[model samples]
Target: MEKLYQVALTMVEGVGSIMFRQLINNFGSAENVFKAKTDKLLKTPGVGKQIAEGLKNKNLFAEAEKLLNEVEKQQVKLFFSTDKDYPSRLKSLYDAPSILYYKGKADINSVRTIGIVGTRQATDYGKQITEEIVAQLKPYNICVISGLAYGIDIAAHKAALDNNIPTIGVMASGLDIVYPAQHQKYAEQMLEHGGILSESPLGMKPIRNLFIARNRIIAGLSDIVIVIESAAKGGAMVTAEFANNYHHEVFAVPGSLTNKYSEGCNKLIKDNKANIFTSVNDIIESMNWDTEGKVPEKNTTRNTEIDLSQYTQEEGQVIAFLRTNGETQIDTLSWQTQIPVNRLASLLLNLEFQGIIKALAGKKFGLKL
Candidate 1:
């Protein structure tokens, strides 16, 4: 009955996600919000005359009941913001949805989650990079999250499916609607491995405003956000902004400055809004993912490549520091060498990949000698 009132409260004309949160928090419950008179509702912070008036609509409960029945018939799962299964990351956001509907076996709160987003008009380069990143992240069992839009978002989901990794598509429409329509098959297949999620209730259209709202969930569900490719203005950039605001790690793949599609990513890097993405190893190293116990054991033998002539200037600087200091912590090396921590992580990963430096326990680095 409380859940029904919660659903009905969402139907109030002037109420939105943030407003819903405020109302519930102030009144102590959704039912309480409904029970309170207009004067009482007005006393809540941010609730004005019009919004408080909307709160008095008694007809919304019938609509809520109908939607709840539809959800039940369709076997869709409903999670209120306060539910135990509600995404913890998303709950931290000030404007997170009051209700979420999903269908799938994937856990929204996976141990490691990443969001890959780019422009809808993804270039071939964007598609390829998206696939490559998802493929590489598979071993870590990262949950790939994205908006179920066209281009890069679809590419990320498809790549995760191809790599047998869990991928979630946060929809701009209702759970019953697939926005692009053509990718319904992809949505269906994802349920076998991941899930399609949304805050919109049944019969809701995929409107422009809804997608802008949808982007927040894409950012919220992620521990990190990677902009694979994006133009100067797009939803991908919006998602990146949300991620940065939420204090999640944001990365952008550097591409040629001449390419128009790369402008958003390049700008993000240049503005110091995102770390430069060098490789999947950079993410793993930055996240400090545990490979020792979680992933399958690999061959312990080191295939050392002793050649140092090909190292970049940054790589050389890191190598030189490790050699001089014997064994140094990553933070210490970053401080001594004057490399940003993000860039240092990438450099160390490159050196480790070439067997030039070995990563020790506790993120320390040493020259292989």
Candidate 2:
């Protein structure tokens, strides 16, 4: 159906995320874009003749159908940008993947998410720090995100599992193919609480460029990214750069001056790109998270009854979404309610004043508990 066309459009030659967005905007759906005439395709912005002709290839649909069938068989969940379950944080980014493949139990859109990245050549100190940070974060019940590489990435995933925290690993390879192969057991174990995700299609191999590209998803999914230990240049640094670009808070754990792995974290601190990560208190305070023993129940039904008729339709729309989805960022609220952010901000402010909702860290709003 429409999902098949969506996968096919992404498979089309030279159809990157930006172009995909432009085409979807112009045609209103991927199905329409594929059905359009070559001349019409050429008329769309940035659609060069080569791309226009590529859309006419009948083989793309067949390939997409084949991939979709395999995806269903593997029990992997596919998320196009427009899908309801697509990660909202990534949706706001201009260059995020238009399609994602996920397999696991954890919600990718968990209310609290953190990214932990570092050099593949992690030292004993680095691994210990990664494990400790994750352990302390258990009470917060946050989803930990990382690229499923060696060193700090694996340490973070293993620690999360030990603490029974939901974690997500963004992989460079297809969901069915676990790179490094050594971590396959950990990857499988993650399925019990966390899961693996990838933008690569069913049979895509993990290439050099894709690994670099995967860092952005790690950055985009997090409210804050922690660089445990990294060299001056590595995938972790690239992830930090993406996190900075996305305006998400970045924290770097300081290390011994002589250690090569500390260079990236030090440079990030020197360049004023990240905060100094000392302990769990830094995260708790920076993110404005409660210091209580356990995270309170969220999105639970309220015992008190309140009439929706008292508010304007737009306000009701916002309230309805929050009631259904729990804490929501302002951007997602705007998208779901079809209200402009500026106007929605005012509505949220009104609701906050009336004690109908409360604002959390990161511009999220939830019904008053």
Candidate 3:
């Protein structure tokens, strides 16, 4: 029932995602937002009389009920913003969606996630570069995230699949509807290793504004945004802008200035909004990944001299990985070490408590400097 109300809150006219979030934070729940008095709604930041009245409309209850039923019937998981299963990276955004409709399975909190975005009209060069980069990243166990559009987005997804890496396709439309329609096959295949995620409700059309809105999710879900190709203006550039605002790393492949498709990438590089992306090693080194699970011998900081023989093999391996990578995400550590996520999570917490290492934001861990 609470989940139903959460879905309805998104349906309310004039109540945008950010507004719904503020309402929920102030009132404590989506059901409470509907129950809130007009005076109380007025007191809520960003809520005006119009939106307040919309919230009071009884028609929304039936609509939300219908949608909830449909979602359940379709096996689509409905994740409220406050739900434990919601994407943590997205939750950090001020405008994070109040509800998410996802199909398929993925570790949404995968620490080594990278978003590969570019123009819908990808050229041969763009496609080749995307595949090559994804191929190189396969060894590092990176999750490839994209908007699931044509061209570069699909290329990234396919490349990740070919290399056996997990990838996620973010949708501007509802899970039931695939935009461009022809990519449905690709989306279906992605589910084997990744997922299709969206903020839109079932039956919602893939409007232009929604595509632009979905770019934020692509940006938020990634540790870095790499634009392989883009025109002077396109959704890829928009995603890059959102990524920059989110304070995540942004990278762009440089192309000939005369190429119209490369204009966006060149402009981003010229403006210093993104780093000049060249190879997968750039991403690995930039993020300080533990590629081969070897500890950097030179990082003899803090307790480096302490004998790790006292710790369990798992703890010792984790310490060694962190020592090599400087700061590694817990999920990456789990992947590299072949430790189950749940077990690794417990190990990380124990290590943090024991002062052997410290946990960082984005579920990362690093040796105490």
Candidate 4:
């Protein structure tokens, strides 16, 4: 298994997905391809004289194993596309990666997975909307996937963790490499729940073209993609394009007309490239997904007729506040209800401890019911 993995890594090095597919088909396995002579390698589908010569000179199989060993010492798991645990969504793509490296516990073959992508430079509105979507997807057993860049990517990951949903970070760089540098800690947290995934081998830079290829894997690995915010030309748009091309459902949140970050998403909805989604239910229905087992159980449901005498006035007031507003800021609630911030915090905390309200990002509280 390890040798096949190492062999696939060699053929895919510096090669695009299509070429990698051709090589895999002609060679039967990465092991055989790596051991093949130049002329034999050239007979493989996509292998030109130059590519064959390149393969012959370098001992990439050994190099890949060495680099992967370094990653294993960091406790990362090297995953392959042929592995039984590989995502079925990805397996169906026309040009799936020859291999993928991962960390953490997300079962790639799980029934639910959603890709959340958007602009690298996000505004406050974008961040807020991304947080809401992540929280909504949490109850639906959705595994959030992103490029793990800045802005919306980090926002999506953080919100997923905050809401207790596992998320996957798909990088254009190698598994051992953490691109964007700023997201290393956030990536670590993802490892704690879902995991980090990448098609590129170690020591590879996350250049422009590489990212475009990575985008396809992201789209192909997901059943649906929700674009939060994006510029007219952005990596998020690229992922959406791949999603559409792959016959996966694509949804975008409409943003302000004048906002630069929203143009790409707005255009998608306007052009019918994607459906407009405001809440998790919209996406679930559009994708024709049954999220019955995905959502967290609701316990805060009150018996409208008989629950009046069961709780104190303060607790009742809190419930009413949550039901009416959906999610309220902790400080805002204290101000509106004339309760001290600390006391209000405690009350809300207790409510959550009792499975009444689901906590959203940035101190916002919403009822689970």
Candidate 5:
């Protein structure tokens, strides 16, 4: 019943991630949000009368119920934002999807993840480099991520399959439909070790804006993003931009400047937006990753119970919020704690310096795991 309301809330005409957060915060749950009076809904921040009225539509629930049935029939998994299994790296971003539809066997929250993106019109050199990069990364036990398109995207996925590396494809279409249908074979093969994921609803077709939106997930899911080849204005460059904004480490292979596909990579390097990707060593050094083929142990030293009396009231408030909400953007912390952004920024820096909390991509902060 809760899952049904969760899906129904997403079907509301104007309810997006931010609004969904606001509703959940105010109502304490999606089911409550749906049952709230129109007057109450109108008072919630950013929930205009129009959106509030849209929540009253009974058809949304019927639609959501149908989708849920389809998902169950197809063996698709739904990851809500509050789910423990949701991707931790993406959960802190302001615009991450409220729900994700996933299929296949790979762990989306793997210990280490890398996103590989490039132009669909990849050259042989680009394809070879992508393959080599995946192969080299095998020993580190990386989960490869890409859009699962043609050219370098497919090459990376295929390489991961060959290397027995878990690879996830963030798709523009629904999980039931694979765009560029020729890659359906590879998509099926991925189910053995990797998987395909999407935020779009079942039966949704690939569209231009959706592809652009899908790039953010690729950027958000990765600890690092590597652009293999791209023209000045293409999907790969867009993904790189999203990565930079998210504060994820970005790397671009230096390609021949004369090649049109290399223009984006060179420009990214020139602008100091991405590091030059020469070898696997670049990623190892940048991320300080271990190459010994061992998974790092979780930090069990941090006690779950904290003595709030040891900290100032404001600091205690921030800690309490983070304790309840895993990773959160600084702006959200400010809004929730009623602290000015400037003051919160300094306070967060102090906490980070004290090793009480760590900064993450997109200006988010979380207690050290």
Candidate 6:
């Protein structure tokens, strides 16, 4: 298929993505496009003046030849749509990439995959929730997918790696370029455990448009997407929107109402694009995912000392508030339970760390069911 590598050849200047695909459909392959006369190209849907003008000089394959050489030189692999290793879930999307460049060792054909996405400036709350949920997703042989930005993205990757779950980072830039260079170490580590994926050619820098395009692959590549944190507007919401468009499930961990990072998630649940998650179990159950064989329901099995004397006043207050209200806001715990704000903060953080209660959006707290 070396000479038949028409897809790579079609990706050159002038053809662009849309026109390249249209030409492929009309002519059957890049070789045919090269062999076809001008009128045959114009007969293709969405292939017109610009594309014909672009292909006027058949020598344009020079760029594609160089790109292919770079791919081999960099040890990168490419997957065209419908390739056996092409993610079937992603291939079903309307906007699935016509080509993808990959590096590293992820199988790409894992049993299942889920995307974890969120803000660059993730909160401590966001980090904790992401790690705990990823830890729970560990045993399902599911590959975790995400953008390789900071905060929740890195946390998810770390947790997945720590738990031996393969992960994939979908990039807005070329595989040859790494965006937000701080992730260099983690990206290298992903090569050992998972892989990095990109739709653009080598040397392409990340642009705003690229990130928007990148989200679709993240959504399409997975059966579901879990929003770890997002602003009232950001890439995570974009991923959720793409997941909704792709007819896939979207899950979000509710954060404090006062937190800027949680606003997008609250909007997603309110808009009915994403389900509300209080625990990893909430996410799995809401998606109708069978967690029975996937992973042990961690917090569902509780062990406790039947004594309140050993607990501090703040801990006592949080527990009482949960039991009384069934599910109550953290603020109400301070107000109704008469615990001071400073102390309530410390206690709830501690209790959350203990997994005694699940924190929901808007600073709401609920008893472990």
> Which candidate's TM-score is highest?
5
- Clashing pairs for predicted structure model 3, backbone only: 296-324
User: Model 6 reaches what TM-score against the true structure?
Assistant: 0.76
Cα lDDT of model 6 by residue, 1-369, tens digit: 533356445555665555555666667877777767778777877767776666666565676778888889999998876465676565544456778889989888665678999999998888888888888866556899999988888889888888888999999999868888888888899999999999888999999999999998898777778998999899999999987766567888888899999999999988887888887777555444465545323342233442456678668766755665555544435556667666777887887787777775424566664
- Supply every candidate's count of residue pairs whose N, Cα or C atoms clash at under 3 angstroms: 0, 0, 1, 1, 0, 2
Ranking by TM-score: 5, 2, 3, 1, 6, 4
lDDT of each: 0.84, 0.89, 0.85, 0.74, 0.88, 0.76
Ordered list by lDDT, greatest first: 2, 5, 3, 1, 6, 4
TM-score of model 1 vs. true structure: 0.79
TM-score each candidate. 0.79, 0.84, 0.81, 0.73, 0.87, 0.76
Candidate 5: segments with Cα more than 4 A from true spot: 302-369
Comparing candidate 4 with candidate 6, which one achieves the higher lDDT?
6
> Looking at candidate 4, what is the lDDT of residue 276?
88
Which stretches in model 4 have alpha-carbon errors above 4 Å?
1-5, 8-15, 294-369
Error of 3 at 22 (Å): 1.2
lDDT score for residue 114 of model 2: 92
lDDT of 3 by residue, 1-369 (tens): 888788889988888878887888899999998998899889877777889899988999899899988998998987777877788777656678888888887777775789999988899999999999998887776799998888999999999888888999999998989987998998888788888999998898899999988999999889989999999899999999998877678999999989999999999999999999988778777776677724345454555675779889998888877776677655446656778767988988898898888865434678874
What is the Å distance of residue 73 in model 6 from its true position?
1.8
Provide the global lDDT of candidate 5 against the true structure.
Answer: 0.88
**In model 3, which runs have C-alpha deviations exceeding 4 angstroms?**
293-368
Clashing pairs in 4: 139-295
For residue 45, model 5's alpha carbon misses the true position, in angstroms, by 2.1
At residue 361, give the lDDT of candidate 3.
48
Return the lDDT, model 4, position 315: 72
